[model samples]
Target: MASDLNIARHGPQDGPPILLIHGAWHGAWCWDGLAPLLAAAGFRVLAPDLRGHGESPGRKHLRWTGIRQHVRDISALITGLDQPPIVIAHSMGGFIAQHLMARGVPMRGVAMLAALPHTGALPIALKTLWHHPRTFARILTRLSLYPMVADPADAARLFLDPATPAPEANRFHAKLQDESFRAFLDMVALALPGKPARPYPALVLAGADDALFPPKAEQRLARRLATTAQVLPGAPHDLMLSPHTETTARHILDWAATLPPGAKPPATAQTAPQT
Candidate 1:
């Protein structure tokens, strides 16, 4: 059975709605710093924990769940909203967002932060591990075997900027939950070619210092999605929790303002992509 997603809503009720989707090993809590900033900027933000992550149930079946299950969860949330929201998705969440778009989910716009490619995270992971063998070996070993929880140092190396405060990094690391191995594989297996081209505007943003998805990959992904890529200097993969959180939120808000007014869809039924 699927678990109910726990959603955290912020900002005024009358503001334009924005849906924030976190990546693997992260939950709605990942948007803690970014959501309020976007909210204060006059957007209503809704961040939801994917099944088996954070406070959501179904952890015991995480290994059995894949991208299809997660897509179902998010599809339900979008359908329940009063309007098609501007989606700001990070890493694996970006992958989910793309699937949603391919399924023809209407939206005001989408902002992808260090998003994984349609081809998936495997190549990125291999490259990252090859570059920083010792550090990633420890992290990947535990991740492949345990699939839940991670070492703070490993998390810092993978997600944090070099100048990130140790305290903040530790706190963020502590909040991470176990990711689904099946979901990771599913992300790798999914491709974008056969899916219908999305008509909605998309902003592809990446961190210059992101080891996982480098600038080249980001640009390539933008090309694949028919959009230009934007890079943030000195930023890491986890931009939301980094010092650049406010800047990222502001950029998203600004981009959203530039979108066509009629892009926002009225409340409508949403159907999940056939798995």
Candidate 2:
């Protein structure tokens, strides 16, 4: 199944590779707007629907799948590439990227957008439970992640900026699928990733108006990575989506220009074991 990931490839074959990782409940479709922009900027972009989301097949196993499995899937993809690709990871995907770094996976660089904090997502979970008791109850009863964004209003509030049109928000909500419940547990307590043993060029960008993880959480993540956070004003949790995608892409393009030219994959890099 490792070879069966639904990956959307774009741009020139010989261009520098840029791997785009979507967050929880989202899939490669979430990168629709941002991928084209990155490809146009001369990047060979690859966006994969992590198992159980989007076109990728794993629905039956989603309930048991965790973050470590997702990381292994990505590690395989990187191993197959001609050169180590720069990774652009968002939200939960950021955690996966951090895990790769911790395990000594080679990469040209990493840009984390609206990433979960190293301290874990317990605070976000508690805040959601306090603010949306009914929804939280549904999540608890069903043992599912969908309840949190089942309503279009809730989805818009959590992931989109207020400036986004209602129709667009509804469409985005419709596309959301159930995330791995086990992965949620891993993020909360079971397997919070630590700082990487080896350093690489890193950037953290967050939405100023994100309802989930706040700017301060992203700032903390940046500090751990030995970098500074850049908060995009009016942006929300889904940075690759509407209103601020171009702005997000511009920041990434600017950062990509600064990476060392012709960097080679490290000998220490190793492919993760297949699940």
Compared with the true structure, the alpha-carbon lDDT of candidate 1 equals 0.78
lDDT of each: 0.78, 0.88
| Candidate with the greatest TM-score versus the true structure | 2
- What's the residue-level lDDT of 11 in candidate 1? 97
How much is 4 displaced in model 2, in angstroms?
1.2
- Over 97-181, each residue of candidate 1 has an lDDT whose tens digit, in order, gives 8888878766778889999877777785576567767645655565452322356876787788888888888887788776776
- Looking at candidate 1, what is the lDDT of residue 175? 80
Q: Model 2, 1-275: lDDT tens per residue?
A: 35789999999989999999999989999899999999998999999999888888888999889999898889888877878899999999998898888877778899999998888989978987898888778877887888887878988888998988878877888898887889989999888986685898998999999999899989999999999999998899998887888999999999999998645565665674322
The local distance difference test score of model 2 is: 0.88
Instruction: Report the C-alpha displacement of residue 192, candidate 2, in angstroms.
Output: 0.4
Clashing pairs in 2: none
Q: Which residue segments of model 1 deviate by more than 4 Å?
A: 1-3, 128-149, 190-196, 262-268, 272-275
The true-versus-predicted C-alpha distance at residue 170 of model 1, in Å, is: 1.5
